[model samples]
Target: MNSSIFTPVSPTINTSLKPHQNPLILIDNKRVACARARKHVTRTKALFSTTKEIVLKEFHQRRALKIISGLQNLDKYDVASVVIAADKGGATHVDIACDPELVKLATSLTSLPVCVSSVDPAAFPAAVEAGAVMVEIGNYDSFYDMGLTFSPEQILSLTKETKTMLPTVTLSVTVPHTLSLPDQVKLAQQLEQEGVDIIQTEGGKFSNPSKAGVLGLIEKASPTLAAAYSISRAVNIYVMCSSGLSSVTAPMAITAGASGVGVGSAVNKLNDVVAMIAQVKSIAESLNLSTIEEVVFEESNLRL
Candidate 1:
């Protein structure tokens, strides 16, 4: 990590994402700060060690999918339905409320990494104990209706506070869309400095798509894609582009520079697990389009 966490790392040509890619990250005088990030992330692999390799492989491929069951959703059946769909549909992970019992429930339902989302730092430790593979600090959309907002300073302070409480667990903090793009960039840098493993960007609720059909879909995803494009370029870690994303714009998220994407309503808003899984598979297929296109390209070149 560089002294300035928000600065770009040595940009490597990402022509492909390999299943067994090496995890070694080299640090020069430029990124001495990220040295600790490399060390701690490795040490903390126990949480998702079972699926870490695949999760990261998909991330590097820019296809890792995280199914969200809603931060405000508490009905066990509803959460469980999404968890089942996520596992069956090939998501890299699942996110639910910060409730410990739900964490346990979600974990039992699927072997995929179980990420718990919350704004409350106090809710994390117990959830971690209950088998949460990763802990997240923002899903601010849930609070938007209540007329609440999380300022950049408040989010950063909460991140620092969460770090103090659980130093070794994988921590993912969301950069509130409520902040200006420049402020979002600054906060993401500070979060990188804080050793956060993943930075999530959200903009679904805030974006009001006035257009209809595909145009509307793109309109909805524009904010987060803008964030992903800017932040992924600036930071040296995974950026989970989320909010208002659909199959059409999902591939755009990765192309825009996100390592993975957090999807909520696309799956959660569905009425049943079957529909949820179908949505999940649709997304998985979309994200897999790059690999498919590459294979076809190689085959065509051979034929030529």
Candidate 2:
């Protein structure tokens, strides 16, 4: 609920983005991010894998993984299947609908933290009561499919209202990737002032790459990546780069300034559980190590 929550757990490192130390603490214990991490070696090919046994214990060091089942998805069986895959695949957490029943079901299936997504500020309290560790107010992709879009003011107002209702709960607000880059940065700063704990950026829904293969994939991830790079420098809170992200873009998000990434559709859309787990492992591995040393923090607070 407060900035102090992340201070003790996340370690500090210098980034080329600036000479000064940047805040690395992203999620705290409230998000059920208390997973213990240890490095182990595989004898098969002399490979080293840093297993994400528990991520909450060290989410800041490694990019946190959140596999979402979708905000509008109400089917418990479908949601449970995704939850099972997320856990078996070594994901740090799972995101599901705000329904208390779904929350309960997800909790029953996995030890990971459950994050409930809903635009209705009122829906959060009950989900929080039902065992959701974190509450997200935006997963704009689902709403956009229905021709609904939120204004900057509306998102800020929702945050204020949600914060009032659940003052002590860990809250993450999404900056609608639909907004212009300048507008998104402005909105991110405002959310921080409102005491929003984490800011999630989304752009996959807006991007439709023209080319095929890697070029297309990068184009698809461009929206969120651009927003992540610009917004992370302006705010001192946790930035989650999500949407249109794949194993290819996951590492790019972390290097861009996001303390972590939230991957939906990419993992959940797959029909096979093994495929879903493989995708999760691929994305998690991308965040395990990065060559980008410095992330320049540029403060550009444009007005909303």
Candidate 3:
């Protein structure tokens, strides 16, 4: 057996009167704080895989675009098309169903970080082992269509189980739009306390648009937008505005304070892979344009 690699440090304290006279020289608080900051950065880098760190950086820049393959979608060809679109279209990552085979297939298709989504905590470990860089607790729209709903307590329970299983893997949990806005904020806060890396908001299934064209698009996105606006304020973690969003509302999501946006039906519903790529590229370009406009507006305000 090899010897242990632990190195022990001396514990002696020098209590001379001269040491007390120049305490700042003996212990520079600024240096200590900076060291701690560097350690934190190192720890975060270690916690997430390199691809995940890149995704998080995009999130921090408020420009992350995640193309989601439905959680219930099992068709390999469909998943492949979606993954290819995300990669060619400039999305930061792709979210797919929590199946190890799908995880493997998605990884084979794109260099983007693959995020697996499921309400079942037990399903995440196998997917993570299969090469998924991140795990999500929901894309609860499918469950809603089945007339099932997730309560805040149940969501918290699921989050706890997932963290226990994969403590270091990046986690994103969706806040169901079925709950009241205040309740959504409360759940987001609790998820943050549980160390969830991201919070996603959804509301398309519940929205009933009253108009067509751009007005309809805005109407469809209102629920998720509201949830993003409310939950982003309530939690310090990044919020991803998802469900019912289009290129028209994608920029609005950023303005609503989301760190990023997740597009699913908007891309995945397309029968042609080329159309899917076009849609993804459109949303990505919209986000970029929005970011530039935000910068210009801020500069103009400063000048004023």
Candidate 4:
């Protein structure tokens, strides 16, 4: 073995350095900083679970399905039905109102990862402690009906505060559809810079579709799809296109560049759990078919 392989080279001495500016000490400090960085990364990775791994894998494959039971929904029976439907219908995870009891109920009902949603940063810790592996900072559909809108600055502030509260928990922040598409993209970029793991898009309630059937479904999903397309391209993080999505438009969401889709009313509005499960299954199948079709097209291109 070469002696150089085991030897440490002395850094060049700088004559401009003050007495306190020791080069060796600076090198040691750098090593310490690097070690601290590695430790942070390790700690962050340690937060992942087998369920989270599966959900993330689905996102990477652009087939992730998240069933949302609604952020304001406090009805235990309704939330429980949604959670069960999400699991039986093959959804990657289920998102419910951020309550410790709801989190516990969701986790107990299914093997899928449970994500809690709330606007309150302080409420997340308790839900995470109760069993929610992921936390979402906004699910503002109900708020929209109440004439509340979150500005981009407000969202960025919320993201910062949420991160401070749960630095290691996987965070997904919604880019409010109230903003113009350009503003949405800008906010998503800022959220990504804040270390947010996922960016969710919403606009279902704002849309007013004139036509019925498939045309109406496409129109209803347009705002969120557009947001997904713009924001997904602007940031490296995952974009979950949500709000007003149906089986007809869930696949379209993937083509628009979302890593996943979140369905709320479409799955949660049904009175019967069986109907909820059927809706979830329909959306899930649409996403899977979309994935398969894309794969075939890519393979065909390779052959040519």
Candidate 5:
């Protein structure tokens, strides 16, 4: 909650893929080009390889929902149920904590990509060996309650060290939302430079924002949303907006330019897994529409 760090303004548009610079944009295999004369022809083989091979190389295609089980003792049935809920709810991936049994069980139970969350650098390699598709450097919200703090330098160093050790595994580093927004942005840029694949923002600790009403919810989530907006713009990697998020603010995150989102308490806190999945799907649909509408409006404005 540093006032000085909130100085940067949010971007008016998502700048990940600029249309003017890359005029030949492809959508579902069809080329949408403004001028035939400006077209840069390529071999069909090259196009096919670029398209199909790229998809095949990645772990998953959709924005993911990483379910974290809050069960006291990690049980196979509980892990299985969460995975089932995630799959049925349309999650592209699931993230479990740094437990070996849960990692093995979750991987065996589902086809979706799995991620492991651990603060220890030593545990990352073992988590990867246990079949985690990605390794997250945090769940900092949990640590914040214990009066712990993570510095940008430590995050950058860990990222470099982690990448050096686990070269092939995808890495998602959480930008400690507890830090000032500028520090968050700086760390995000550093992580990107360190070759981290995904950046996630969280805002549940340091102080819990009230969840009583609309205004209260916004108050609670503004920090994470601001982090999402600033960090996503500063870095080229995917940013998963998280913490204090609900169905209402999901689209807001997308409009602010998050490539994805991760919800733990919102889903795990619920007693009914089916209802949780439905709510998560509703939020996902809202984000999908928001992204499409933004793209369409940008395309239309370009035509004008």
Candidate 6:
């Protein structure tokens, strides 16, 4: 068992009394009052949802590695190899496109939970029916190149409709990193209110910031990180960080407050399946170590 990886977070609160108020009365003060308010609302809804058994279970019990398969015009053999490697490499879940045949093939090849991605709400139920353990509203990264835009209202509506349509199946709604950081946070909070099981943050198309090295990495990941930080603080449900993420950047993601991280180009671009799995495992290990270290350090300081 990883002691550091799953340590519970301690809650901290600071309060001050206003001179104008009764001396005995103290008011709570925090840097992010709105976030706390949102969290309260989300917790209430989550309680209700849990009572109904609409809980979103994390598939990756140890550490999660979600292998993305089936790129544009890719062959079935290639997809099969990816699935086989994912299974052998200890992938927690596998994500495939909405193609029917590919879903069938993936399910037959790997017992790992399978997730299917599509932008249309109409495709969600069908994907679930086809044995997708989870469904995501994504591939907008590819669509953004063609001048497509996904608005907050549109995303909220899709989430509501999807939940109403498939109450049993888990739904992961992708928050477009294309939106401003505030907008991303707003949409995330709204999604939680609308009964979205998971909120996945993405950032590939809005801009490419990796060529500039460290500064590039910061620019590329900042939006998604901000969204993760804000949304995770505001909601108790899972938030999966993604887009332009590599082994180097994955740990930064956990530090920024993501429940899990998703990778595609880093793993998919590799020709060797074993290398991909190794990279994924390495990222998960690093996150566990970092988390443990932070917890230990905080405890030591408090004792001092």
Instruction: Itemize residue pairs with steric clashes in candidate 1.
Output: 1-31, 1-34, 2-31
lDDT of 2 by residue, 1-304 (tens): 5454334432442232233333443334323444432222133112211221233333565457888999998987779879998887767778898999999899899988888999999999899888887889888787788899999989988999998988766688999977899999999999999988788999998798999998899999999999999999999988988999988888888899988889999977888888887888777667762222112222222321
Q: Candidate 4: lDDT of 127?
A: 93
lDDT digits (tens) for residues 1-304 of candidate 6 = 5353213322221223333443223223343676798999889567545632422343222234566763342468767767776676555677778666778888899887777787776876666666676777765766776788898888878777777876656778889877887888888888888777778888754656756876776777776777778888887667888776766776677777776677776666677767766765665555563355468899999999
Q: What's the residue-level lDDT of 142 in candidate 2?
A: 76
TM-score of 2: 0.76
Please report how far candidate 5 places residue 136 from its true position, in Å: 0.7
For residues 1-304, could you state the per-residue lDDT of candidate 1 as single tens digits? 3353322333362323234333243224326767778877776665456444544666776667999998889999999999999998878889999999999899889988888999889989999889886889988887998999998788888999998998877788999999889889899999999989889999988899999999999999999999999999899999999999999999899999998999999999899789999999888888884456568899999999
Arrange candidates by lDDT, descending.
Answer: 3, 4, 1, 2, 5, 6
* Structure candidate 4, residue pairs in collision: none
Candidate 2 residue 52 C-alpha distance from true site, Å: 19
Q: Candidate 3 — which pairs collide? A: none
What stretches of model 4 exceed 4 Å from their correct place? 1-54, 289-304
User: Model 1, which residues run further than 4 Å from truth?
Assistant: 1-57, 289-304
What are the runs in model 3 whose C-alpha is more than 4 Å off? 1-52, 289-304
Instruction: Write down the lDDT that model 4 would get.
Output: 0.88
lDDT tens digits, residue span 1-304, model 3: 7542222312332343242244455467668888999999888657666656766877888888999999999999999999999998878889999999999999898888899999999999899889898899989888877889999999999999999988878899999888999989998999999999999999988899999999999999999999999999989999999999999999999999999999999999999999999999899889884456568899999999
| Model 2 local distance difference test score | 0.80
Instruction: Give one digit per residue, the lDDT tens place, for model 4 in 162-205.
Output: 98988877889998888889988988998999999899999988
* The candidate that achieves the highest lDDT relative to the unseen native structure: 3
Alpha-carbon RMSD, candidate 2: 19.4
Worst 10 residues of 2 by lDDT: 44-53
